[model samples]
Target: MQANTVEQIAEVQRKYEELQQQFRAEAAEREAAAAAATREVEQRKKYDELQLQLQQMIQMF
Candidate 1:
């Protein structure tokens, strides 16, 4: 292949690798956000349950 053609191919390959890296990073960030949301929901549920139990105990006294 000609030198110019080879250079063009190399440039394309570099751009593709950069895009792949960005895609992976974005996917990781999304996964982390989803996990955090799940944790928050779980904590809220626990807090509500505790509050309910406290109210029940107070009524007994």
Candidate 2:
């Protein structure tokens, strides 16, 4: 191939790699946020259960 054609191909390849990297990073961030939200929901559920138990114990007394 000609030199200019080769350079253009290389530039396109670089841009494609950069876009792939950005997409991967965005996916990782989304996964991390989802995991954090799941953990928070679990914690809230546990807290609610504990509160119910405490109220039941108080009622017994």
Q: Model 1 residue 1 lDDT?
A: 64
Worst 10 residues of 1 by lDDT: 1-10
Angstrom error at residue 29, model 2: 0.5
lDDT of 1 by residue, 1-61 (tens): 6999999999999999999999999999999999999999999999999999999999999
Model 1, position 56: C-alpha lDDT score: 100
What is the Cα-based lDDT of residue 52 in candidate 2? 100
lDDT tens digits by residue: candidate 2, 4-56: 99999999999999999999999999999999999999999999999999999
lDDT of each: 0.99, 0.99
Worst 10 residues of 2 by lDDT: 1-10
